[model samples]
Target: MDLSCFKAYDLRGRVPDQLNPTLAEKIGRAYVAITGAKKVIVGYDIRLSSPEITEALSSGLMAAGADVYDIGLCGTEQVYFATSHYGMDGGIMVTASHNPKDHNGMKMVGPESRPISSDNGLNDIRDRVLEPFANAPEQGRYETLEVMSAYVDHLLGYIDAGSLKPMTIVCNAGNGGAGLVIDELEQHLPFEFVKVHHQPDGHFPNGVPNPILPENRTATADAVIEHGAAMGIAWDGDYDRCFFFDENGRFIEGYYVVGLLADQFLRKTGGGKVIHDPRLTWNTLDLVKAAGGKAIESKTGHAFIKQRMRDEDAVYGGEMSAHHYFRDFAYCDSGMIPWLLIAERLCQSGQTLSSLIDARIEAYPASGEINRTINDPPKVIAAIEAKYSVGAKSVSFVDGLSVEFDNWRFNLRMSNTEPVVRLNVESRADKALMEAKTEELLQEMDRLNKN
Candidate 1:
């Protein structure tokens, strides 16, 4: 009866109390009833409760006359890949991503792997869960689907494997599902992988696999330095988003990776549109333009970026948060594809990752997303916007308040789920100015929050 798992983009909540096999079954029925999906590809992550929940969900799907193709023990993107790769009617991934271990949720996609978010059929399905469900006269069949070979082939297709030479790379799976795919890919690639926390353990011994947190990054960084790796990569539990660390063991900001990927992808395609988030722009814009590609800004979030990629026919889309979407991959974000491309870049260029990123950092210094706990985020944002907009060369609100001047720019946006204000500031080739402006802005926000 508790459907609190439904969210703006996907379903996420504490398990059983908010999400259980009983509720998952009803949700399966509601999903089939609302979306009219005849063939649904279902996948689950490495969580203790995932198998049970997935079984109940499949039962409901079959009961609702929708055949189920279960892709067992996979990442969220695998569901996205299976849905579009097989031309299925829809797909659902049972994953809570980086949420606490006791929590579980689902991310759903309709035909062509388009997201089914709150504005779309997600809300409808949530409402339908409250209604009675009658089984169809003919129950749908259930079958196991083995999509790894095909999915791995698709991932490798994004890179020039022949150009990839021998190199040592560090990949920290954080005891999530990414290690499974890395094992599969290892057979084909020449790169030597120093695997850390590499296993699909639902128990999550090294914590919850979220590499974004500073504390969670130490293991990966330490391994990269200890092993003398070319670069290090880390992924969340479901492996939809991946984080990067250079050979020097410094965690590269995701914003820089966005620019690097845009450049790498654009070179292969000759010229194409690159979708990016507005929080940090100068570096991406510079690289995109130099690569002879057009840059389009989209509001942050996977659904928004994916939709924008589809609309613009973009070759690649990336967010500072580490979600990279590819046109060839049905406009879905993939943690696997980004790293493969980076490996290829390193192999072909014969340059260290830090050398490539350092130049760009010098060109555009950024405050890599600072978060502040505020009582009234909206009031603080509006107040900050009013004061900062006075002499700004340009101002816009594609996602939040973004103000630009000749030498410096900053973006202040409130978190959708919390009373936190996220701020990003950047300066043209001046880290000192960027730091100063960041400090000044933080001080102003603090001053406004008190008022």
Candidate 2:
């Protein structure tokens, strides 16, 4: 019983060896035992091993006296959508997300589509998997649940579809499950979709669908330019997080998208809280305030952002890493919703994506996110903090060490799962200053690492 597949947020590991039908079934039963979920929603991604694993998981749920509503061959958000949409007791998505193709995993959520991560129920479920399971007094039933139509309708509800005008939009699914969704949404919109790597293939001929990787972006960027699209969008394997490319075929950093989405969502809500991560702030803070919305910072990661969204009753939440959570969608991240809202903005404002983003970039120049592998992340980060905090106007540690001056700020935080430290620096209306400060910080970090 190698349960190494269980992770901080979800379960992810190599197939068969670390995760297989055997372990999946146990996880299913353990999930039921821990959460007391009677009616569970089960879904899987476009992975090669997903069907068999999902079947085993459903069996375990059934054996534990929890009826299963199987939503087959969908992305992770679909599970999130179905659980809250139909008022299921809980939901589990069998997906590795953007992990390597050979790996598989699961994302679980309890009632109201709240995440069941390590601190809450995931650890309990993992421990329970070690125990023996008994057949329930009555077995739970299994039925295929067709949630696509309703789910699509829910997605379209997020935007003004009538305002969407004719334009060429590039969508590179990267052979992941997002294509299925785009196909469903295509009929409702006025835009002409330039589909690239559009088919849902677990084979991932275009390579794992993680558009965040610089190498994986070319296909979408190239297609956007080739088709002269208004904009381009790409998604990870499970499509929970989506990346964007402007009309000029340039990849837009997720931080900018966060600001854009915050502004767009705030307009619709009239005025509401917009939740954001601490790693990068000034841009989002500016946009959020300009939209007449208050900004709240949460520690990064889906669980933290989603929980914060629930607590604040936020209209929308976003991370520089591309996860966008919407309140109307049960505080769950949706790769689809962000793009539709952006399209609507484009149509209504009659502004190119680049023009909209460029102004924000000029207002707040950022170093993006830079990761450095260090032998001692804590020591290096602390030392950097000591040196940088001397004349800093403010310093805080909501998620990481953020030291701010009048016009510039930088945040250095250790990766939750790795020895790498990520650094992000930004300056108010000064790209040169931002670049110079970023270089200085990286050099200082490297020097500290050597010491």
Candidate 3:
């Protein structure tokens, strides 16, 4: 009944302490009760604690009179796929995404893959689980299902090998669940892959299995350099987000990947809508517009973007954080889709990854997405707003806070689960203005905090 396991968009915490079998069971019961779902599907990542949690959750769901479909050991998207694939009432994924091995979490979706955020049903579910209930339904049952192979088939269905160009690429799974996909992908795809940390080790002896960190990215970049690959790709624990490294061993901002994928998707399905987070890149907006497709910008998060995608019937949506969603996949984001399309683009253009993103970097230079610690983020944002609101061309609070000018823009937002403010600055190829504006904003944030 300790509700700390519930988070902003999912249920996540450390094992046994913040999370355990008892807690998972309670969550399952509460989820079924709140959603009124008669049947539910479940999946998990490659953590040692996953199996135990999955079993406990299933017990809870059955207790609540929900028929459970157990899809053993799969990525988060696979659960999303199953929820839509089997026409189930709801689904749950026991994963922490890219969180450390010590951490685990759950993501739930109602019918139609609609999210259960704190405002919608997560808080209600938490309240239900908080109260002790001894009696549960006795007429429920569970069935096992293996959908990984089917999920793989769906991934390949979106692209053709004949359209894929041959190139050497480095891929680092960071010892996460992506190894399963990489192992099968090397044999099926046309690219020559240089592998690093491809084995799934729950201990995460290499690192936390997140390509976002500079340390975790070293192996992937080194592999690209060593093999003289065209590029390097890496994934987090759940393989929902894919990061890229150019041939020069430079880590490309995921925002660029958003643009790259948008361009590719727009070319295939011209004039379709493309969704992107507002944190970084006007390049996405430009590319989408230039390609004759409508650009829809949303606040930064998977839940918000996915909701918008369904509402707008967008063909594709991507966030600078590396989550990519496709309309054909029931508005679910997959780490597998971005690279597949990139490969297709390379084949069509006969260009390498470096060549693909170089023109974008020159066209729309960025401040490289920075995160900073601040004791009081609101005070900093307030001060910035007060100072800039007088003359700013526009000020928006769609996600956190964004202020726009004639030729430059920046957004400073508080992290959902941390005491840090993430800042992203962009300009129309004016490097000096971007640096000066970034410094000024950081100095202002520091000055206000020290006060």
Candidate 4:
């Protein structure tokens, strides 16, 4: 086994080479062995390789004396929902999640849909999968299940159906797994959906299904403007993370969405704790405080965010990368719930999406996350820390290097899943300062790269 395929939070690698059916089967057996799970749930996305990998995984699980329940061709969160909602022992979803078409991976969770990350037995499973073991004398059985209706019902539970306005919503699934769910959901919604690339095509003919990239965002934005929709939403390959654009076809930074959702949840629940990542803070902090809710900072990554939410009993948590977690949804991130809640909020308040966040955007001007590929991430981070810590009011190594002053702050961290350093800067309603600092940081990174 090429252990490099294992990541900090999940398995992701180039397909057939780093990950394939053979490795997936071994992983499936090891998962059962590690968790002692008697009943396992398996699901896959729209990727061409996913169905074969799911079959191989199920075979291994059954061979290891564990019964398998297969929920075919679904999003990543469906596995989470099926596991926790049906009281299954564990679950795995075969998805690369916005990676290149040549790549594939798996996301695993234990009972109650708790993630099993590298720190939490993923490495042990990796090691165990390498050794040979005999199959159980009595092989377990496999069964097929349908979870969409129940899943749609759960999604609708997050908002009142009657509260939705007869507005037009532009939905661009990017030819990924989100289309299926959107199609199923439309039957129950009052809004008209302007669908773009709505079919699930593993070929990814419409692009790689990642709206976070600037190049991939134009389709949704254009559709929204052309169709005169009230809002636009785009999802990644597996539909775990969602990106948003306002009625004017302008993309809203995910940082602002975090604050927006935090405000919404606080108002609904009469105020509760909210968790956010350290990369971007001021907007979320101000909104959270204004809503009479506590704001807690957590390390970035789904595993860390979910665990922190569980520990704090937070009513809501959001990452600027578009992952939103809710206390009611087993403390797991869902791409579907965030948009539903936003829709409901717009309807209830009779406000445009852009109008809702315009003030907060002005109050906390930010440089959206920028990424640079470097030879040595740790050395670059150390250099940044050495340069900034001298004049900073506070410095934190919570996730990476976060230096804070009274008026400006920034966090530079290495991505867990990619070979790059990400930088995010924000200022107290000063866009010029934010841009100047962002440029300075980029120049510094360039200097280090040349050296």
TM-score of each: 0.99, 0.99, 0.96, 0.96
Number of the candidate with higher lDDT, 2 or 3: 2
For model 3, what is the error of residue 230's alpha carbon versus the real structure, in angstroms, after optimal superposition? 1.9
Off by over 4 Å in 4: 417-419, 448-451
**Model 3 C-alpha lDDT per residue in residues 114-135, reported as the tens digit of each score:** 7788979999999998777654
Candidate 4 lDDT score at position 354: 90
Give each prediction's root-mean-square deviation over alpha carbons. Answer: 0.7, 0.7, 1.6, 1.5
lDDT of 4 at 10: 90
Task: Name the runs in model 2 displaced over 4 angstroms.
Answer: none
- 1-451 in candidate 1: lDDT tens per residue? 7788999999999988999999999999999999999999999999999999999999999999999999999999999999999999999999999999999999999999999999898999999999999999999999999999999999989988789899888999989999999999999999899999998898999899999989999998998999999999999999999999999999999999999999999999999999999999999999999999999999999899999998999999999999999999999999999999999999999999999999999999999999999998889988888898999999999998999999999999989888898999999999999999999999998998888
Give per-residue CA lDDT, model 2, range 76-190, as digits (tens): 9999999999999999999998889999999999999999999998999999999999988988999999999999999999888788899999998889899999999999999
lDDT (C-alpha, whole model) for all candidates: 0.95, 0.94, 0.86, 0.92
- When summed lDDT is taken over every stretch of 10 residues in candidate 1, the lowest stretch is 377-386
lDDT of 2 at 313: 95
Evaluated at residue 259, the lDDT of candidate 4 is 95
**lDDT, candidate 3, residue 73?**
80
Of candidates 3 and 1, the better by TM-score: 1
Query: On a 0 to 100 scale, what is the lDDT of residue 186 in model 1?
Result: 98
Residues 229-296, candidate 4: write the lDDT tens digits: 99999999999999999999999999999999999989988889999999999899999999999999
